[model samples]
Target: MLINEGNTNVFIVTDAVLNKLGIPAKVTDYLDAKNISYHVYDGITPDPTFNVVEEGLRQSIAANCDAIIAIGGGSVIDAAKMIAMSQGNKCKPQQLIGILKARKPSAPLYCVPTTAGTGSEATLGAVISDDKTHQKALSIDPRMVPLAAAIDPIIMKGMPAHITADTGIDVLTHALEAWMSANASVETDYYAASAVKSVMHYLPLAYKDGGNLKAREEMGIAAHYGGIAFNKAGLGYVHAIAHQLGAYYSIPSWSC
Candidate 1:
């Protein structure tokens, strides 16, 4: 099922922790077995900055990557989206903000989420840092959405309790805020309600037993649903305030 004669060099953007934990290595091993050429850039930090995006972009361009496969949490995937699309646009990540009116389409992108939150794989928005202004800016464009998402529950079994809790909360926040947003539609409401129900039913089990595949799957599905809901309905004060907190304290968005 390798597409385009397997000439697409998949650029995997991830964090050092996941790389050290061997997730990227395992994925690379599989890709190698399938004779798919790929490269891994594990330099993306938590709450990534524009500089980090630029670094990944440089590597991707040098590798002549035709596609991107992000294999970590939201930060890694967010950075990958920027890297995947930056090849077509010369502007910096910050300057590409405010609805992404300036960006052109780029290579196909895929996401493999190791964590069951953030839902960056399903969304079209990426938050990049503006170092000069000490603020975070949103890059919003349908072109930023990944062409496919691989939601593997086995990969999420390694998440610690705190990560599970925080990400679960993030999912809840996304659903509720989306449901109540002024832009909410019937389609979004259905997805939001389903996400809320799944989080309430499975988050505690996933937190208590990280290896529970059922709970992990539910959370992962809920996260994706929440992402889809919010992408259409938009988020409210919670996300806006959280963005400010991330910018003000240099904290990760999930932490807020």
Candidate 2:
């Protein structure tokens, strides 16, 4: 339900990498064939700053978009989440930079991930950096979660080895942290274990062969389960330290 078939305007959010790979075109072509009006904001960066969210917001509002669809990996999805969240809250993204700070629900948001990383499509949290200070600010509102997501292996089969390895490791980290969480429940344990097992079996295959659809599918499902586990159980030192590294060094979260 990302876009209505007719007479609907959508703001498509993405990044340069996905645009270069023509991932957004998949969605745009569908929209085009269905006669769904869409505007594209593809300026999102790796660590997504408040400024990037604002520029996207400006374009979205100018277009009077009724829905938003994000197509890419974590950065693109996270930026789109914040843009949608900020729209409904009627405030700057920085204002809602803490636990459940958003006063209103987000605008309609959907995700189509291009990599088996971050699982931003299934999470309640999004991170944005301060344009001025370069420090990371987090927003953890259930409202920010995407309304729906499309996990297609065709989109993920093109990932480079380094990224596949990095994100696969990142997926393992998520499950491990979730399983170790103090708040972890049996529900979280099941998903965490499933994700860990999937990574153990499939990560090497995907890393060695990007075109392996089965491996790509497993990695994507592993990431999704990792997100589900962590969403409830929360994360541990890995994410915290990763955040610090990302803030200080400008490293992407999926980087190992």
Candidate 3:
């Protein structure tokens, strides 16, 4: 779907684990069949730092990639957003931090979320950590939103139980925070409610049986809905404090 948007050379962004596992072959194989040019940069860490973004941007620029595709969880997606935006603006990733900092929209960005959590693919924000301090900085721009995403359950079927549980709780947190925000409205309420209900029901089934395609699909949708809800309605203290603590301690959200 992304290549159909007229992108020629592509830059594939992901973590070392996913790259080593050869999970990106899911997309690369298709690209190969279609004769699309692409380069894979798999240096993203769990909490990506500005250095990581810089390295990715450098590689993508050197490869002359016109499009960016993220194929991992939240951290990978976030890094891809910054990489695309920086490449589009012809600047460093650190310079793009903060609200509405970009002079133009990001380069065409697409996502294949291997984990049904964080929903970074659906949102307009990306968080990049400081190289030395590990403190997170959020960049918000409508341009940061991906052009498209694939939430294939087959891709998620290999996720371990612990990650599934952790990400499911993250989905629930996003929905609840959005619903409770003072900025929430009728439109946000619909998405938030749907996500909350789906997580409450399908999370357990997905956790119990990773091969349950129906459960995986529902959770994936729920995570996307939660992201949309929060994107519009906003989030609260849970995210406010959790983000800092997670960045500070190098832990993921909901681990405590």
lDDT, candidates in the order shown: 0.86, 0.89, 0.93
Ordering by lDDT: 3, 2, 1
Choose 1 or 2, whichever is better by lDDT: 2
Candidate 2: list runs displaced more than 4 Å.
3-7
TM-score list, all predictions: 0.95, 0.96, 0.98
Per-residue accuracy of model 2 over 83-121 as CA lDDT, tens digit each? 999888888888888898888889899899888878779
Best-matching candidate per lDDT? 3
The C-alpha RMSD in Å for every predicted model, in order, reads: 1.5, 1.4, 0.9
The positional error of residue 52 in candidate 1, measured at the CA in angstroms, is: 0.4
**Residue 200 in candidate 3 has what lDDT?**
95
Candidate scoring better on TM-score of 2 and 3: 3
In the range 1-256, model 1's lDDT, one tens digit per residue, is 3365355577888899998999888678878887788988999987788999998888888988877888898888888888877765755565667786554785678888998888889999888877667688788899989888888889999999999999999999999999999999999999999999999999999999999999999999999999999999999888888888887788877798
lDDT for residue 27 in candidate 1, whole number 0-100: 75
Model 3 vs. true fold: TM:
0.98
